[model samples]
Target: MLGQAVALLCLLAGDAGGLAFANAEPAWREKERLLENNKTLPCAASGTCSLGHTRQWTGDIYPLQGLRDCLRARVYRREIILVSENRLVAGFQLYDNMMQMGYDHIVLMSTEENCKRALRAWPQVSCIWSSQVFAATPKYMLDRHAFLPRAARLGVNVLCLDSDSMFLSDIYSHLKAPPLRDMALMALKDPAIGWLNSAVVYVQNARPDGPSVYVLNEVIDRLERWAEAREYMLGRNRKDFCWEQMAMSDILMSAVIGRPIAYGCWNWDRNVTYRDAWEGAHKRYFGYNETGGIGSWHFLKETKVPWPKSLAEHAPGFRRTEGVTHQQVIQIPNTQGVWPEEFGGPLYAPVRGNKSRAWMELIKSDGMPLWADPEDPAQAAANAANRELFTYLPEWIGIAYGQDGTSGYWNPALYRGANGTGTSPYALAHFYRLFGAPMNKLTVKMANNMWNWELSHLLHPRGGVFFASTEHAPIPDVLVYSPEVENREWVSHEEWDKATKALTRLAMEMGRTVVYPAPRCNLTWLGGERNNHLPLEIPMQFKHQCIPYSPSGKGFNDNRCMLGGYLMQGCMAARWYFAGGMFPPEYDHLVVHIRDKAAEHPVATVAAEQLARSWDSEELAKTLMAQHGGLGAGLFHPKIAEKLGAAAVPAVPAAAQKPRVLIIPSVLQLTDKVGPREQLYRDHEREDFNVMSCPWIQNKPFV
Candidate 1:
């Protein structure tokens, strides 16, 4: 027969690792004896079954080790079947660990092909494959076909497991708990996305009526759903892993299983769920008095697969229990530094049950202070001093404040460069005044980079780049994209091509032109020809280019700062791509320069001017060396701020022909001692003349 004999061994264990369950069952014991005494047995059929080694562990800075350990522990207890060439080698390791604890009916299962390979290596074991039982067929379905038949041959009761699983607590007792008389086994119900999680599960092998044909059918149906929705598969973009989990869980939940209670079942993730458990535990364990409970946890590691050399490696004294897991945990020093501490947890009074003053001081000193006091003379002095450091713009190059980042209870006016003066929102009424219409120019800075797509898309419908007559509407005539490269991964090539082409086409429709800096060849290549390359490497440091903001709720992005800088930029960019429409143009003469003095290269000038044309600048100038004798010679000087001072300055108007220009100070925000925003005004009415700062928390974007 093509089908071969299969054996199933079950053992009880306490720790997620199989060591605790080694001698728990007779079947396990039998396996142990085979490993110890049987020298003549086929490598594939005898001894302990071992799997592949997982990657190394680093510190809590990386989570891969914890996840690997958990999975290894869970798989060790089972009579695992492996259809691989190194059956004997694999079997030996599995047997070694299982027998060490005492239980051992470990069997190494493999296919004939694998057996043949094993023969050349250490072939002493028997083998099996679906071809042994099923008639000759294609090999693609071998794994699927082999699974059920192998389980049936193993005596009707089997546990199906994914590679990523582990046992942290004694699961054997629960597994061994009297099987439901009617149902042979029970399995966990999966959770939905935008819903709760459904991970750890229990399964009963036999049902009084029959095998779980219903459950199997449900799996088949969902798999079909997945097949139909192939384009939307989670694996497609390598993003939205949660979607994959959701899809799988949705399928699992489709089954009409009996009331199956869910305990802590972990899968391949560690997010809010894990953080919450630890948070709650830390709170209670430190005397908060709340019942701290965690049914289960998935130790999904970070991208770096290496495991921590030891617990101490993740955090000092992490291995040695510190004071209160809670108190000490507060300043869970970010091993990864992926996000700031504020998002990690609530700010306690730096006090714990023990109330160590030193510890309190340490917690208090975790992150930098976020607020700035305008009244403080030191702060004012600092702001004033920093203002001189800025490279002033030309009189013709109007500075209009774009609503790249604005937040809260009032309408923030755009900075209108024409007629020097601008409207400032100092009171709540300003918000009411500017409501219902789009604000002035939505500056496509790093923070609001996403808005670029929105304008691009909206303007694409009408003349590609013209502003709408409506208030806060878009005037597509001018569009800007800067700080070149960032979050490049999330941008889909298809969407990019569509958007760029749309931008080009829209510019023509509006009877305007487009001026974009040609992307560096290398960057263009990185994204292929389809995507726009906005590299974050140049014009500013990563610190200045990326900022953290809230996501969800009454906060930015979603109120939670769970997603860090890169993702936030990607999401906003995506949203901006779809945000449709341009605002009314409040300015006529808006000059954009592409030159930065430090990087004195012609290529920069060439690229900047090109970019200026992309935005349909009314006029363009190229500064040059004296030898060239063009505007280039006098256009930009070594100390050009002095030369620009001699030119006729535009008079400040009550309301700029353009909306108030809000200088967000993105890349410019850095290279300074303190933040660049003006400290004087709060709302739009306080000062109608432009030049104001929104109530921005340090490192936070306006909602």
Candidate 2:
């Protein structure tokens, strides 16, 4: 026991691959013992160590004891350890997010200098150098969780994720230990999908019975198959995703087979609002309401949980002014109160002049603003035009004041609600878009508001479900684009709106998210001539969008600053004055680029009243049609006679739950027989565990 403890402690104290344990008992025994006495272990600054905990384990787990000792964070000792991969733009934002949510044991695997410098100030935080994570290729996903085995070896459960995952409240509450199940999945029942984001994952022991290890192996196996089957990419930035989703989707949906293997969720929804860059960027102003009602907060069909209804009611009150920053109103802290009515909208700016200048941007001439120049036809015309156009947008696009009372990407409207504002916070949002530290007023206000709200919803055992629900990472329901037409001409808002209006109207009717082409930044329109348009980028309604200056790329990883992803986020909004279609590898359709000016015609975004039936052999299809309308998920032809039937039924959500199956061998018959619920259903059924219980037979979709 002492030898094993020394070995594990040695591993933490700059020893890599030096210890070889012949017996699992000793290693496993010390694993918990050291962890139990982790506080006594040497710390970074504490003189209790030999060489002082070194950085970069090369491929081993960098000693994480700094936080536990220096700041008493006891990071690895916590049952639910939160880990994330941090890169540029994702720095510090994720760290502050988890801390503000009050999660104590947090580690951000980041090598960026900014993250290192920033986190270095606080000994409570662990900033690790991780090259095996956030890889540019899908094959690297196997490396993504290499740290998990280390955590498992230490007997701690880990929740691994990407840096963009913004937690709304206390994730610790849902994930904190009591050992409810082998794995607590972050997904919804309806989608019946598992591993929604792949960014957020939870793991326990590496044993076969441990669901985390099982699911992870399955994900790696699936990725291995896909990687083998995949075509080679010609370029360096081969950004491919949705790798583990299909296989995990099969594993999670076993409830459809009446025998599920530890599928799970959190907080009623599977971590809602994964991806919402295009749609959410517009939600700062007004949006559609729930009940699919005709109201402002309409973040429909995006994820398991859409944007909360709490903020929707306040949307219309957000932007009183559009695209114009009021001189110098005090930038005040809006924490713990109703969302203050500061001016602004989550809308695009009219890029009609040079230097990416918005027509509404404060234009100074003769040392005075041009907005005051009524004599200037362009200024007068620009103001009139934007106001008239606002009514047509899918959601309100009030270009409002951001941080510092100037036009900024940080939208105040986003933090208006009191509950979970950031779902795993935001995924796929471009970095540098209103990004910074915990001190940022917007970050504080959002975190504080969620903490205040969570006061009422602490997890309770009698409350019924074992874990909280989570959702898929953000992915575009539909991607809308328009060619900037050789990067020379600009798409007029009228034409842009007309095209998007037609497209979004159709998509919404189909219950899908629809996007209109809104460039993150704009270019100058010089003398209406091709050669005259100097490529000077400027401040506009949408800031932080460096795409115009960035070299275009095929995907997210290709962008130099990670900014050039409009086709991958860029060039599409660059070249296409107008384009419409779903993003590639998921849905296939090329965007139809409309002419920049005077083009008022379009259609073909694919819309209908309902889904057209798609199926296999006519015999099965016909039988399904004749009986159950259509086969959903899968089908089991009225079976080879078991003389027994167990219908589909989801277990009711509970606050906490016991093991789904409690087995007793025949030789060891239980003194207490099966619970009355199990006894009653002995013929082939069990009592309701609620609608989502995996053990209960719900092999088919209720529909």
Best by TM-score: 2
Candidate 1 lDDT over residue span 239-319, tens digit each: 211232343232222121111111121122367676566456434422454543422121111121112122113221112
TM-score against native, each model? 0.22, 0.29
Steric overlap count per candidate: 117, 62
Candidate whose lDDT is highest:
2
Give the C-alpha lDDT of model 2.
Answer: 0.28
lDDT of 2 by residue, 126-214 (tens): 55543332222442344444455444434455666555344433333332322212233332111112123344455544332233333
Off by more than 4 A, model 1: 1-96, 99-112, 119-127, 132-146, 149-155, 162-171, 178-205, 208-213, 217-248, 257-703
